[model samples]
Target: MLMIKSWIYCCLLTLPPILGLSQNLKQEVEKRIKAEEMPAIALEILATHLSQASKIRYYKETDIGHQSFECKFILDRLWYSVEFDENGAIEDVEIKMDFEQIPQAALDKIRYSLSAYDRYRIRRTQRQYTLAFLSSDDLLTMVIKGADELELRYEIVLSVKKDGSWTTYEMLFDQSGLLIEKKEVVDRQTDNILYQ
Candidate 1:
């Protein structure tokens, strides 16, 4: 009985350290996630952007400073990727599509939509053209143009609302010097809600 009691005491003492290690690991992951600045709101935002047929193919926690969740999804023959923090905020979004995959009719629709806006002159080089548009209040300025064929990129800088939503009145064009393709890369709120 004495020996048994001693063994039990030893076992109980060991349990605390084991439990502490587990808790420490969890905390570490959480800390890493927060450090990456992943926003929780991004999850809902991304969900709204995907289509009904889109399915999550891969998801894993990244060790990149913060606890980041890298998720890949397939929708409408496009591959989409979203990185989120542990708290579920979106860190970045990437959409991959081929120029040949987009219908010319859809591209035309995108160009026609841009005609309504007043365009300001943008700097141009031999290969690319750029344009800028100011928001109604002149608080936001959007520059749109082309970069390259394989990638369509947009850089936006705008003010954030108190609720964490961005107030963006600017627009960006694709590497083809057209605005139609921008919608294919970025997920809009309507896309988000509809996808959800």
Candidate 2:
């Protein structure tokens, strides 16, 4: 019994952190809000493209000790998600896109990378724009002009089979399908009231 107890203790100690739990909070609520409630910087950047946008919705993400804002809208029939830091600086802009939209070379690379897994299913894909130190005016111009000059990256979510188990992971890849970051999707927290 002692040996069994020792094994259980080891297993519990080495367990990985919960997949979906952010480092900042046990739970996070992404609540939608009015555009007017957002900071001036974020609004100004958004205003440049408002002429062609539809169904614009703003959301504020508040974790225990972190805050960020996001605006999602449809532009020219394409879905766009723009995230801003607390200071209203553009963090990243994501455009929902089809998997086939990836360039041939990048698609090939992504397939090769996925080959390591036993099996995988692509869930979603997005084209992400991240410009470094770009002025609001430049961003406004670039966004309004369809982002043709920007180097966009692909963000993909997939359910992958590894070691005979299925796990969901969010992966970021450059235009060339080079791996940038991989994070496992965590499950949502259970309600304590139900258990109690």
Q: Which one is best on lDDT?
A: 2
For model 2, the local distance difference test gives: 0.84
lDDT of 1: 0.42
- Local distance difference test, per candidate? 0.42, 0.84
Task: Show model 2 residue runs off by greater than 4 Å.
Answer: 1-29, 63-65, 187-196
lDDT string for model 2 (1-196, tens) is: 9999999998775564444333543455699998788988899878868778898999999867889999999988889888888888887888898888899999999999999999999889998888766864475467657867788899998899999999988899998999999978765557775686
Error of 2 at 9 (Å): 18
Could you report the Cα RMSD, in angstroms, for every candidate shown?
Answer: 19.8, 6.5
